[model samples]
Target: MSENPYSYVESELPRLLGNSSVSGVYKNKPEDFEVIEVLGFSPEVVEKGQQHWLRIRKVGVNTAAIEKQLSRALKIHPRDIGYSGMKDRMAVTEQWFSVQLPALQSMDWPAWFAEHMHAEVFPGGQVTLLEAVRSHRKLRRGVHKANHFRLRLKAVENADDLTQRVQQLVAGGAVANYFGPQRFGKHGDNVGQAMRMIQGEFQVRDRKLRSILLSSVRSFLFNQYLAQRIQSNLPYVNEGDVLILEGSQSYFTVSADDKDIVERVQSGDVHVSGPMFGEAPSPAKGRPAELEQHVLDQFPALYEGLCAARMGHERRPLWLRISDLALTWPEETVAELSFTLPAGAFATSVLAELGQFTEGEHANSTE
Candidate 1:
């Protein structure tokens, strides 16, 4: 690991298929990037339940602020409001929020929004109610299956080459699933804060902020491990590797003699995983375990702090597969791209592999 574990360039993440030469400007305006949540369950499942779920389209607002507003408007504690995941503040995003209304309390949502849907409610941002339904359960974080993105890239060059790169990515069946810049916070201050906190040089009393900082530390270690694998030209899965099944959180360790694991990896049934350091014993063995240990060895303080904090062990995939990728040229200088990624994956990770963008701020703008 380097002196700054979290300072590596996003483009340095090994491209699974190869690199692309395309260049463009991303998110030139709020309307340029759009995200729609894909709730895996049907609305009818919760129609007769006590929870009221509202699907909202918000522009230039983050999830926390919207949750706060909902709490005040409903005259309930903040904990009474639930959301699946946080959406980006700068993009146009549609997501679901669940409110735990009393069993006997039922109000017309349209009339409710009519009176409370003003600047006073969402002070710095704007939100519109798209749909309202009843659900039996609150929308917990990470409940959504995936997020579909529609983005417009401006001043693009070599449009034909970009198309070829997308094809290669699809055929190769993987893209390096490095935690995007967003995980590290603006200017990557979270990583620095985590290092300080681990060293006892800084203290974060807020549980939420502390959790986020610790996550940044874990993400740094994961990226470092993945970067080394990419640098070594290692295959996605190795003997004795722990592999995560596609579309599931469950994982299993591969035996040294298991030759079919590679086939399973190539067929998109499983993926090679990197560690999210915590208290649990490492599930990996042999070279994979050795590789992970090497990375953690560079950040002893972070490793010790994580152990002391008693965080649970977890694994994240090293590669992400883009689904329903489509490209269209809205103008000679503009390109539109749409794709769907698993809930925890970042859309910017896909863009990083495509090429360098002129407007670099868009790198971490995804929800």
Candidate 2:
């Protein structure tokens, strides 16, 4: 690994890290912070319709918070409230959850969710529980629009230079798509730990969780590969840019130099590209390009996201193309704010763009 590991030596018996191992897994300090808000609204009525969703500005709080409270006058498991995605705990986010209120009709759904979830309505109307239904496959992962973010950086120097760079890129529509700093611990502990576990470099007690964390490590490296690409300034390669599409280990290159390919990749049609990890990557190459081809074929947009991620992490672009983020910044003295980030991006990337913040003296802030 190119960096130091963040995990503490447990008398030398290393284990996979959790929230505890990560010092301030979420960054604190008013100076090196940024805030992003997520807000969504639903219609005012449960009018019989095919749509079955209620948008909120927050996530991960659990359906019970909203559903149980409503049960103050009814009864059911919060899980009965089918949510499309899990959101951040700190940010004000909006999303949809399904209700089984098919036989009942009520004009009072808004008051119930607001009073229960403590979420403020941002748009649409109210919690519109659709009365109609549609036949479709059961909800799967990554099915909704992640939260959109707004960020502000701290310790900004040469703002004009940074702004000019971003404006020019936006005008020409180019940005380095790199993984955010979150991929590496202040050092590279997260990466190291995940790598060891995946390669059977350690003696893990749990087979299932160990496997899951190993997968996360693979995902992290793919981001690293993309990050490196962004840092290399290859997104706007000669002619235009190059989208290195990976399927399994075989890479098929797409010349983004063409304006249309660039537009589709940039406008969210096709996310940027990065290595696809079929198996764990060696430490030297960061396990890049070991990706499975069949899987990559499914997420065409993921390639584009990696591209943006590469750029976002490298240049620390301000105008975000990411759909979700959770940030904290100097909104006021002695006060810190928190929120949730959707899957596929980093909150720290948002902070890096807001401004460069030196790691504070606090132990928690170090990671």
Candidate 3:
């Protein structure tokens, strides 16, 4: 394949605002980068609850480890705990977690955790329980509405130019929704490993790790299709492209000859989506399907492997919109950015467009 799934080239994606050489240091400290998960659903009050939901603010700890700690402290199975999404351990993140606690067996949670699971109890003061409340249901993965980020960039250069570029990006209404490096394991070896598995040269015995590898394979293919779209710079759609309505999973196929479809794409009411390869032929038709097929054809082994594994098809938007994008200069050498993205989107994808930077050690550590 022409594309290298292991490496990301920001230049491959067309920058809505022109490019810049502005450089900065990211995530110098855990507190410098913060994220708050936006849970769209309100917790339904339960008169007698079987589940307890927690809002936790954690630093230097991954979600799984926190779940393990919660399990230990509560004397419950790890599977009994749930979270909406995984948060990066290198940054300060506030998110929700749920525990199944039968009413008859309930303990004084606040007092019990305060004594056994306080910050001092964890090494390096990594995890903290901010609040606990009764919930009628568990917090499930991918249920969050969005993630709000507060990022600090240090030793930034060309501050004025960077601000202009950011404004242009906001005005453009879409950013390339490339999967960040975190999707691929350390140094992006996951893609290679996945390819080996597909070729029958390797086997992944662990179910969770195997799932992650498979996801990496699919994401790599999606990124390839997206990169080609950006590189082509074609009005974001081709004849017989699959188009998805904004904020909805519903989609329909339309040819480029259709005027209404063209208008919808240009007006930002809908987006052109690319294939997440699977067991069957892509739902897209005509030129769009051809483009996708060409990319998949380059990786025959991967395509066959995914089909053999019975991976199902899906589509992701070619672009993402940034909501409430704001930037401030805290110092001549520092810039702070805050914005919200739909759940499953990456903050790094937005940052890549702003400027070049040395990624923090924790940047790719999130699972």
Best by lDDT: 1
> For candidate 3, which ten residues in a row score worst on lDDT?
9-18
Estimated TM-score for each candidate: 0.93, 0.49, 0.92
- The CA-based lDDT of model 1 is what? 0.82
Candidate 3: which stretches are off by over 4 Å? 1-18, 256-258, 262-268, 361-364
Q: lDDT of candidate 2?
A: 0.37
* Regions more than 4 Å wrong, model 2: 1-52, 59-81, 99-108, 118-140, 154-157, 181-193, 199-212, 230-272, 279-343, 350-367
Task: Report the C-alpha lDDT of model 1 over 30-56, residue by residue, as the tens digit.
Answer: 788899999887665554588898999
Tens digit per residue, CA lDDT, model 2, 128-190: 232323312223334443444443333444444444433443353332333444333444455
Rank order (by TM-score, best first): 1, 3, 2
Model 2 TM-score, all chains together: 0.49
Displacement of residue 64 (Cα, Å) in model 3 is 1.5
Alpha-carbon deviation at 261 in model 1, angstroms: 1.9
